[model samples]
Target: MNLVLTVLEITAPVFLLAAVGFTWVKLGFEYRVEFVTRLAMTLSVPCLIFVALMRTDIEPSALTTLTLAAITAYGVLTVLCFALVKLAKLDIRTFLAPLIMGNTGNLGLPVALFAFGDQGLGYAVVVFAIMGIYSFTFGIWIVSGGGSPTKAIKEPLVGATLLGALFLWQGWETPTFLTNAIELIGQMAIPMMLITLGVAVARLSPANLGRAVWLSVLRVGLCVAAATVVGLWFALPSVALAVLIVQVSTPVAVTSYLIAEKYGADSQDVAGLVVVSTLLSIVTIPLTLAFLV
Candidate 1:
């Protein structure tokens, strides 16, 4: 009963907001979803990440462990996808990004917060910060054939992460006013991202759903299973293990859609994967956590 309530408490708002966004679309709220997603990705989400990281104390010891875990988890996922892609003879340029990009920011971050509160949030943020840098740099190199590497390097959120770190490095306190403002904007990231997600979902057609569903299932199941076995062997903390597991288990990120759209991959396929995996994740994530607990 408690677990059921906990799942609902954590996830209900997400589904409800998605429904609201869908309804607003049906009701002719033109571009509602697009507007929200653009704002969230460009501003609110970065602010949230910056504030979270800045507010937390940097523990070098724990940082090493988290970094190792992230590298291991991501590295394993990449390898697994590569093997699968090759074995299945899938098109690498179009399908690889979607298959490999885990839902670190949206689903993973929230689950981390719920499972482990502030600590989990911080750890998850750091893992994703590292992942984002890699995704933009190495991911772009792989996807875009090395042109405009600078474009990949210059994400607003990267700037925000650096600013937050600079504050920490310089030992400067965040002014009360600035901190408060950042907090307010940061809080908007999660809900807005979800709504943007809904907009993305609303756009997907049934024709693409078949392939997307297969990819999503394969991505989630294989990646999470691999992470679970490794995490168990590492003797990571329960919360940390849970965090890593959930992060790896999440569907291909919505960013996969954007990247696919840019690089001429099947954007429809990517979006469908994102939407299906995210919805399916509500069940898979909590169950994975329950098992870990």
Candidate 2:
């Protein structure tokens, strides 16, 4: 009834933007995913993160608590997913990172924004930042068997997170003109990410979909459970807890497939998980929001 419409109002625009990308690709339009992703990550996304963190009125202590909670939730997921991978006899390198690192950025941010507005976006950014740090460091190490920790430090998003956090801690604000400019750039991030997600999905060639289906189901279940436990244990406010649950439980990121391809670890299988899990998210995310809202 009213609840269903509310959820739809929140979710419809996200999938529709994605559908535009999917349909564009299907119609044989030219879309350079690599270039778009690089632009978003390096410029737009960093701007978004920096601006959001700088302007957020959320208490520093609350953010610190959520940070610890996100870390604990990921730790718990890592342990659980490792056991699950071992039991399923899947390639640990390929399956583990994707399972542990959900699509918190491309999918999670926008959903949070739609469902809970600016404050939700701010909270979601914290979770996304934590996920980004881990994915760049530990997630890469797992996939490639070797990676430099310094590389993660060099990432623009990481740098932005650090800078933004410092600004928040100091209660500093950028000049009005600069803040508005950065915000304009930041505003581009969500739509670009959503459309890029669709383009990536339209292009992925998933394999062994049956295996991917079950694995995706497991991933969703495990992420929601871990996030729930950690959020409640930390007593995160209602919106923060709900944001954490949704972000952690998002579908497998397309980057996992790209990393697998780069590192030579059954990219097709990872692609399968990405596609299946993302498609599965269309249903799972809204349902989760139905309750959270």
Candidate 3:
């Protein structure tokens, strides 16, 4: 019972803010998704990542282990998803990216922050960084049917992650005034993302949800299993392991749909996967957290 309440407390604000966006969209309010996304990614998210990494209490070595663990887990997920898509005879371009990459940023970061406080956010940021780089580079390649991976370098969060990691390693801190300013911007990340997520979902026109349902279930199982194996193999502490599982098992990202649309893949199919998987998460996330918390 205590665990149930703890899980609820951690999850409530996240979905609630998202609900606000969803309802706002339904009521015909104008929320510019592309603009909000640009603002968050270009400014707020970078600050959040830098601040989290700089303020983290986790040792650099533990972070290194988590970093390696996240990479391996993603590698395993890539292989597994590829095989699943091939066996199912689905278009790899449309399905693989969404399956391999979860909503680690908008969904995963907030969940980690609420569940495990700053330490968890710190760990979550590491995984988010890894995912961001991988998704931008290789994920774009897969979605676009071959492309230069250099675009990942253009993302502001990439620089922030590197700079923040450097700060952690060298025991550096920004001046108090700058830190406060950066943190104030960073504070916008979670709510902005959650609301944007809701807005995006409300606007999406999904397709073939019956197929998406089974694929989404398979995705959740495979992702959590891969993370669990990698986390245990690395002997991650409880919080790290829980964060890994939760992040990996997050729903399909809205970015996946946009990438598919931009690259002329089957965006409708990807949209279905995103919507079905996200709604399913309302159940799967709490159950997983109940056990983990």
Candidate 4:
């Protein structure tokens, strides 16, 4: 009973913010997704990642372990998703990336923050960074049929991750005033991302709802299994382990639908995955948290 309330406390703000965006869009209000996304990715999100990584009090060794574990977990998920797509006779290009990469940023970070506080946010950032790098590089290549690794390197998120990791390693701190400014900007990222998610979903028109439902179920099951195996293999600490499970098991990201639309890989199908998986998270996240907490 107590755990149920705890999970509610953690997830309510996230969905509520997203609901605001959804309702705003349904009511025929204007919200420019491209501009908001660009702002978050280029500025706010990078700031958030940098600040979280820079100020994290977790041991360096623990961070490294979690990083390797996250990489391995994603690697396993990619292979598994590919096999599933092939066997299911699905369009590999359309289904593969979304299945492999979860919504670790917009959804995962905030959940981690609310559920486990700052340290969980710190651990969540590491997983999100790894996933972001993979999504920009390999995920793009899969969607577009070809992409450059340099594109990932050019992303501000990647740069922020590298810089933040360096700062963490060296035990360095930015000047107080500068740190405060950066933190303020970083603080905007969570709500903006959540709201953007709702806006994006509101605008999307998902197709093949029946198929999407089952596929989304498969994605959740496979991701949770892979993350659990990898976390146990790495002997991750309790908090890091919980973060791993939650982040990896998050719903399909709305970005996947955007990528599919841009690359002409059946955007409607991808949109279905995003909508179904995200809706599924309202139930799955709470249940998973009930166990983890």
Best by lDDT: 3
Model 4 Cα lDDT, one tens digit per residue, 1-293: 77778989998999999999999999999999999999999999999999999999999899999999999999999888998999999998899999988999999999999999999999999999888888888988999978788988899988998899899999999999999999999999999999999999899999999999999999899999999999999999999999999999999988888889889899999999999999999999998999898
> At residue 93, what lDDT does model 4 achieve?
87
- What stretches of model 2 exceed 4 Å from their correct place? none
Write model 2 residue lDDT over 84-145, tens digit each, in one string.
99999988998999999899999999999999988898899999989988998899899998
Instruction: Flag regions of model 4 displaced more than 4 Å.
Output: none
lDDT of 3 at 270: 96
TM-score of each: 0.88, 0.99, 0.99, 0.99
- Ten contiguous residues minimizing lDDT sum, candidate 1: 58-67
Model 3 lDDT on a 0 to 1 scale:
0.95
Give lDDT: candidate 3, residue 71: 98
Model 3, stretches more than 4 Å misplaced?
none
Superposed by TM-score, candidate 1 places the C-alpha of residue 139 at a distance from the truth, in angstroms, of: 3.1
Return the clash pairs for model 4, or none.
none
How far residue 150's Cα lies from its native spot in candidate 2, in Å, is 0.9
Off by over 4 Å in 1: 32-35, 165-172, 206-208, 230-235
TM-score of 4: 0.99
